[model samples]
Structures are given as structure tokens and as C-alpha cells.
Target: MSTINTLGPHTPRIALIGECMIELQQRADGSLQQSFGGDTLNAAVYLARELGEGGAVDYVTALGDDSFSDAMCQGWADENIGLGMVQRLPGRLPGLYCIQTDAAGERRFLYWRNEAAVRDCFTTPAAAPILAALPDYDILYFSGITLAVLGAQGREKLLATLIEARQRDARIVFDNNYRPRLWASVEDARVAYRSVLPYVDLALLTVDDEQALFGFADCAAVFAAYEQVGTPEVVLKRGAEACLIRCGGESFEVPAQQVERVVDTTAAGDSFSAAYLASRLKGGSPAEAAEAGHRLASRVIQVPGALIPK
Candidate 1:
């Protein structure tokens, strides 16, 4: 295996902040297989696995003090992810969801997360310490789902943390994983996203999500918007098609890896973002990083869940 030295002054720590939920998959025989998933958590695991001990990866989120939450923490620890920042709230529970797929392997999700513990992650007393320590990380990673769950006040706190972290020269990586059902309206999501754009150093966007959220006519508009936000690196992912990337004042299109069969598309973008960021943090060029993203995402989509077995 190839190893890349850590970047920046510190030990190169990455904090991925978001919620993880229990996932149930409805099988063909009417059975349900219990699992767990979240976009940021998925990226955290993949990033930790990709970085291997070259850098530290931490998953920052709130969970209930239940057995399921305990198992989630244990799993993250086993994967070499730091747990010191995970907040556990009393009398709360993690969210749950079910994945149903069609014969063609296209997937749809049904969520029961309105009252999930993570919604108050940044508001709880324990969140103070975590937010205070966040500025020390070398990189801060989060998704649109993270923003949505945080709501107004929590998002305000998180945005402040991002500002402070950016002032310390920490790189911010954002993935545009937009779920319309998660927000009150598209306008709300647009406002929330625009508010955080100034702090983003790298953005991993999906073409469809961008179009849906911001109403961009095409990829050019997406790139223009990111450029306006002053983000130095931008990668736009289009499922089964080529991904467009802009870095260091240049642009390139990297084709996706062809998969014979796609069992589940759960973590395709999350896995891709992980590999791409991992490669970039290791000093690979944008084109090389996009290829790495495609390779990992292709493998992930061939599997059945957000997390594939190692």
C-alpha cells in the first residue's frame, strides 16, 4: 500500500460532522435487513480507510445513549475513527430509515428522523467543547444533510465554527448531498448553502442536486457559481457519466468506471468524495483524484449498502 505524509503544521486531522441512522433494507421476500448509514459517516469511514494512519479522521455527531448508538461508536472506533467528539444525549434516539429498491436496482429511501438526536447536536451543552476543538483540525468535512439537521440555531453555531476554523487555515470540504425532504423548502436550503459557501475550499457537487437546489441550467452555471463563491477546487459528479472538475485554474472531465451491475447506489457520491479528497490530501492532481473517486464509487455502487464490507 502507498502511504502519503501528513500535510500542514498539525497531524492532519479531519472532522466529518453529521448524523448516522439505523437503515433497514426491504428484501424481495418481504424481510428487512438492519444496517446503518449517513452521508458524512459514510465519507468518514471511507476517508479513514483511504488515509489509513497517515492522518486522523473523526466523526462528529450526536447520538442517543442507546445500544444502537453504542454499536455505532464501537464500529467507528474499530475503523480507526476518533470518537472523543461524538456527543450522546440523554433520552434521545438515533433516526431510522428504510431503503426500497426496484428490480433495476434503483433505490428510494423512507426516513423517520424528524426527532433524531442529531438535530440538537450543536445546541446541547456537550456541543460546546466539540465546537471549540473543531478549529484545531486540519480539515473539516460536512454535507448538506449536516446543515439541514442542524436547523437554524445549530447551523449558526456551525457556521461560526467554520469561520474560525477557516481563519486558522483549515481546509473545508463540502459535499452537496441535497435531499429535498430534509428541508422545509428549496429556498431554505439555498439560503443555508449560500451562507456557508465562503468558507468552502473544496466542493464535491452532484449535477442533479445542483440543478435541483440552485436551479442552475447546466454544469457551466454550477462552475460559475462556485467560482463566484471563491472555492478553489470544484468537482461535479454525474452518475454513470463523466465528472467535471476544476482545480488550479484548469478544468478536466474524468469518466466514470463502468459497472456491469449496480446493486445499490447508496453511497456512490459519498465514496467518490472521500477518495477524491483523500487523493488531493495526498498531493495527487485533480484529474488523478477524480479517477480515484470514480474507481471507489464504482466499487461501492456494486454493493448493497452505504458501507461495503472491508
Candidate 2:
């Protein structure tokens, strides 16, 4: 929208905050395929791939000192994602989830994460320094799941860090990846989302999720809400339809790339958000960024997991 680089001239430093669960995808043959994925972590990996050597992408979350955790870290490292902000707590474990996909590629998830190590990501004794360091990055990326997982105290710390980060001129990017089961109630979810809206520089929203969370009637209502909050940029992603964007007081739409077939819909939005941010940080216009998002997302849905092969 600005036409100039969205993150200034330097290569941006980005930190994505959320959990990365041990993902188990149930196959048609009744076996489970294992991997690691979560909203922000999927975005982090895709962002790292999209940015390549042009920028830095780091993942900030607490993990357990276990074999699965070690494997998750190694996988991220292979994707060129930085783990400097990751903490390993003893005797704890990462969350686990099973993905079941329908014939049309839509996915449903069953989670077991009540005791995940990342639940204390921002409240542990070792978290003060991490919170203090968050403001130094060029951009902070997170999602609604990040808010949900980080209990009340942890969310407060994150909000404080976001405020401080904004004061220091860092951009805050948010994805409204809403899952009703993650919150105690719809009202509670609404409260948490409202608390962070005013601080966001860019918001990547899926129409269905917004509608489910805030009860917005349509895309128009969704945009109106973000406009009222004065968010600088907002992108509304509609599955198989054009993604509408509002930036700098103007709106634009970009159609999604048509895919011949979809194997799994996991991480579709995550890949899109990552590519959109990557394009913007590299000086592309909002429309161009949306096109980039659509391109990457089209490819992701053809794969069986949250991450396609590099």
C-alpha cells in the first residue's frame, strides 16, 4: 500500500510466537503419519523458506527436553528457522494433535495439549529475558492460538511486550486463526482478540474464522471492524475465492490460484501469511503480496501435511 518497503530498507528480523505441536495425520489406511506443526510455527517455516537469505525468521516457544522436541528443533533448523528464543523445560512435553481430512481436503483436528510446555512460554522464570528481547526485532508475528495457549498471566506479559515493541517502532503482525475449542468460551475469545487489535500493524484474517469468532455477517463487516480499529493493513482470506485487502484506506482483491486437486488443507493460511509478509518486507505492493500468498497457498493444499517439501 505504501509502495515503499513495508519494513524499511534493512533485512527484517521477525519472531513468530506460538506452539508447535507433534502432529499426527491419520491416513486412509488407518496408520498415523508424524510431523510437527502449529499455526505460527507453520508460518515461521514457510516464512523462512520464502525469505531465504533475504531476512531472518525466528520461532519463540517453550519446548520439552525430549526426543520429539529435539526432532522438532532439528526440523526447524533444516528449514532455516532460528531457535535462539526457544526454551526447553525439563519433564515437560509439546502438545499433540491428530489431523483427519475429508475427501474434499478439509481437515479436522483432535488435540491433547493441556499440559504442553509452551503453555508457560511467557510465564516461566526464564521468560523475562525473552520478553525483554522481543521488542528488538523488526516484526513480531503471532496468532489467536498464541493468545489462547498463553494463559492469562502469559497473555498479559505478551500484551505488555507488544506495547513495548510498538513503542520501539517494531511492527506487529497478527493472524486471526481462531479455534473455538482453544478458549473457554466465545466471549473470552472475543475479549482476548479485542485486547490485541489496536496494537496490530497487519492482520491476516480468514473470513470463516472471523465470522465464527466475532459473528461478522460477511467480508464487509469484517473489514469494517478492522477499519474501526485503525489497523494499517488487513487481508481477508476466503477459501477458493479472492482475498480482499484493506490497506492505507483503500481496498483491493486478489484471486486465489486455482488448484487442480487438493490433498490436504492444513497450513493453507499459514503459507499464505508467510509469503504475503515476505513479499511486503521485500517491497511488493499489497496486491502483489496477496498474489504471492495465493501462489504459495495453492501449492501447500496439494500436499499431505502442514508443510510441503522444500
Candidate 3:
């Protein structure tokens, strides 16, 4: 079943909308490994890696005209992700964050993003043109974090954009990468999520986050809620367990590849979402896409950060 109608006979273009931050991964000896990462950005990178020439991918976000921002652009370019939709806001700066991991490689983050340029991504002067162009893409992908970063005005703009995009037959894909600290309150986050869920065609969800955010009693409840919203395809990822997928009125299960030692689970879910979307874009069935998702995410967690080396 096709999710998106391609703009034309050209390659399918998917735009991932979110932020990229300066990431500092803390080591045991007090050393820090620095890089650039964000939920949708991580998905952008991996999706690009997965699709190389199979499709086209673009990252839509706002960044400062700073050196770090320059480096981030350069890095994205190296991965062949499109920068045409990026906004370079003068006098603003990209946000920064540090990651700390427990012995089991579970990670926690400390953010310095209150003033990040991306907070006004859809509110900036350049945003009007970008928003105008966004609806033309074959697919529009974003995350819960994307919603959180965009303030009230930006969220309204984004909500309108999503509606317009879908009206043009662009498929909407959403990943539930919820971070409690990002929103003003649980209620605010819930409102933002509900505003967008009805437009989503495919939902990549984390079981626990759904439980926490919507108080979903269990996996069944989560699926019922998404089904009620009429999300045609839903993939539920329960870390280290078999992922469940319901698409085209059928259900499937894909077992994740086991890792002996989980190094860092930073981008596990993001990477999974990327590979799954890439697979679908490349004509794989929902079941095959889930397999691709598990394959990539298995490799991601064995690495030290959100992104593994190409």
C-alpha cells in the first residue's frame, strides 16, 4: 500500500523537521566526546545512509550563523542530506547538550537549549518561504521533540503546515520521541500531540513513552488510541524485544537482533525509525521495514552515541 503520492516522476523527497544540537558524551575518566545530534536529525542521518540513491532526504531546521552551526551543516552535507530548507538565523546559536550514561549504557541528557535558534524555527522571517515549500515534498517526517522545540506560535504554524501537506497527498510520519522536560507540562505536550496525530499516516511509537504521555494502560491501549486517530500504520518498539507492526489491516512481529553488550542506547529508537521509513520508501512491506529498523537499531546501540560512524 502506498503512503505518499510522489510530487511527480522524480525521486521521492522526504523532509525531516527538527533540531540538531552540539552533543557532548561524557566518558568515565571525565573526558567528553563531542558531536552533533537531535532526535529527528539522527533519523535524518540514518535515513540518508539507508536510502543513499533510493530516494532524497532533507533536514528542515533553523540554526545560528555560528561556527558550530557551520560544522553541523558540513557534517550533514557529508552525509548527503539536503540543506536547502535550513534557515541560518543571525545572532542566534544552536543548542548544546551533554549525555551521561549509566553502567548499563542507558543514557541521560542535560540540555542547554532554552535559547536555541531552532526554538523559533517556524517563527522566523525565513520560515514563511520554507513552510511554503514543505508541502510539496512527498513525505514529511517529524518527532515529538520537533513539536516540543517549536513554541506556541511555531506549533500553530507547523500544525497548519501538516494539514496543508496532507491535503496535497504528502504522507506524514511521526516518531514518539518524547522528552518530559521539553514541554511546559504533560498537558501541553498531550495537546500538541493530539493536534498532529490525526494527520499522521504512520506512527513509530515507543511503548513506555506512550504510557507516560497518554497514560496508555498497555500496548493494546496504545494501538487502540492510534487506531482511533485513524493512523493506518503503527509500529510499537519495546526496547530489546520483538517490535510489533500493524499495517494495511494486518499485524506482524519482527524480532530485534540481540547485542551482547549495549554500549549506548542514545539513538536506538531514532535509528530504528529512520531505517523503517527508508525501507518503506524503497518499496519494502511493513514487515520488511520492521526488520530493517531492528537491523539498524541493533548496530546503533553497540556504538557510543546517537550516530555510528559511516
Candidate 4:
């Protein structure tokens, strides 16, 4: 029963922890479109757009003191996303990737990110101060991609921070965005994911990714896995179909809005995760949040890239 306009204040502060990379897209006619994108960064931008001035959204990542990094920071500031915690390492550069779409508009990405500056984000000497400030936020948002990028030692530090943050009453929101290529093997991702599950309050899962990563037979299996990890809210997104929600000991089905044309499916899940979290921060129920998710994702896929123009 929640209308988008009826949503209340979003004063809660959320720190989105991840990387943003330079994005280049190949058009059907062999032209190229340049932009910036990353899973959690997309979520941060969409979350800010949905909340407007209602909430405090900070993007936590490390960038180099290069022109591309400078441009990226300026763009985030233009979107009203906080960059105070972003570290600028000397002589390093941001990551880059290219997107190519099939005839069906389905997308594949080629990354040049193995040497991205963000890989050392949490392990750098400057990271001590940044990690100290994270627990002050009302919510902490991250994804599997964030984990993969942080590497093992950095992830250990992050896991400790997540535990401390939750102990201080901050809610943890996680998205299961499994990019297999980012990790050495599926077992590595499984270990990283398991280490963080017990502290998660809300988990946004993509059914296809879960099936590919964890071999979850269905939504039921996904729900069961999270429940065992003590996650109270679980939202499942199945592309083009209804999303499933399990919260407060009850489950609900929220259908996605039908789009006339699907230009590109990139960032569909990222946008949905943002809207859903924004709805929750505004005090909407899980069912209502799922509806908000679908509303935003429906609008996103109709556009050509991971980020749609505001």
C-alpha cells in the first residue's frame, strides 16, 4: 500500500562500500559511448536519486589522484553523493571496462581492472582512518563484487568492521552480485560470502546469480540459506518476472512492471537493490520495498546503459 510519493523521510545515513570504474560501451553501429559504472556505485547513485535530499548517502572507495579519478569524484559530488571517505592514492588510476551487447540487448563486460587502484583500498596505510569512520553510519551497503576486489586480507579487515558496525546497531545490507571472473574460484567466493552472512540484516539476491554461484535450486533454497545465516529480510529478483520477498515470517510476490522495450539489461539489479533499500530506510514494508525496486528497475533497463540519465 505504499505509493512512491507517500514515502516518508530518509534521514538514515548509508555508506556504500565499493568501486566505480570507467565504462565504455560499444554501439550496434560500432560506435562507442563512454561513462562510469560499478555494481555498488550504481546502487549509490540510484539510491541518492530515489531519496533526493531525504538521506545521507556516502560512497566509500579508494581512487587514484589521476584525471579519471578526479572526474569520477566530481560526478559523484554532482549527484550529491558524499566523497569525504574516498582515499586518493598517489600515482594510481581508476579501473576501466567495456560493455558489449548482443542482438538481444543482453550484455557482456570486458574488464581491464586487475590493476585497479581500488584493490588496495582497504589495505593501504590511509585505510585505517577510513575504516574507523564506517561504524558511525546508520547503514552499510556492499556486494559480492566488493568482497572479490578486496582480496582475502582486506576482506578480513572488512569482516571485522561489519561485525563492529552491527554491534553498534548499524544495519548491514548486502547484494549477492556474483561475478565469477572476479574470484579465483567459486569456492573462494563461497568462503567470503559465508564469512559475512551472519552480520547481514537485508540480503538482495538475484536468482540467476545464486543458481550459478551456490547452486540454489529455487527461491526456497535461497531463502533457507539466508534464514540459516539469520538474515531477517530476503528479497529475490528474477529478471522480467515477479520478485519474491520473505520478511516478518511471511512471503509475498511482487510482479515487475512491463517495459515496452528492453534496450539494455545492465544495472537492472543494481537499480532494484537501491530502490528497495531506499524504501526500507523510509519505513516501508518488505513487500512495498520490492514494488519500489521493480518500478525503478523497469525504468532502468529501457535505457541503454548501466546508469540512466537523471
lDDT per residue for candidate 2 within 1-310, as digits (tens), equals: 2222556778889999999999999999999999999999999999999999999999999999999999999999999999999999999999999999999999989999999999999988999899999999999999999999998899999999999999888999999999999999999999999999999999999999999999999889999999899888999999899999998889989998999999999999999999999999888889999999999999999999999998
Candidates sorted by lDDT, descending order? 2, 3, 1, 4
Clash count of each predicted structure:
0, 0, 0, 0
Off by over 4 Å in 4: 1-10
TM-scores for all candidates: the values are 0.97, 0.98, 0.97, 0.96
Q: Which lDDT tens digits does candidate 4 get at residues 8-92?
A: 4437788999999999989989999989999999999999999887789999998999989999999999999999989999999
lDDT of 4 at 130: 87
Q: Rank order by TM-score, top first?
A: 2, 3, 1, 4
Better by lDDT, candidate 3 or 1: 3
Q: What's the lDDT for all of these models?
A: 0.91, 0.93, 0.92, 0.89
- The count of backbone overlaps in candidate 1 is 0
lDDT of 3 by residue, 1-310 (tens): 2463323566789999999999999999999999999999999999999989978899999999999999999999999999999999999999999999999999989999999999999987889999999999889999999999988899899999999998888899999888999988999999999999999998999999999999988888888888888998999999999999888777778999998999999999999999999888877888888899999999999999889999
Estimate the TM-score for candidate 4.
0.96
Instruction: State which candidate has the highest lDDT.
Output: 2
Candidate 1, TM-score vs. the true structure? 0.97
Off by over 4 Å in 1: 1-6
Error in Å for residue 253 of model 4:
0.8
Report the Cα lDDT for residue 150, model 3: 89
TM-score of 2: 0.98
Cα-based lDDT at residue 146, candidate 1: 97
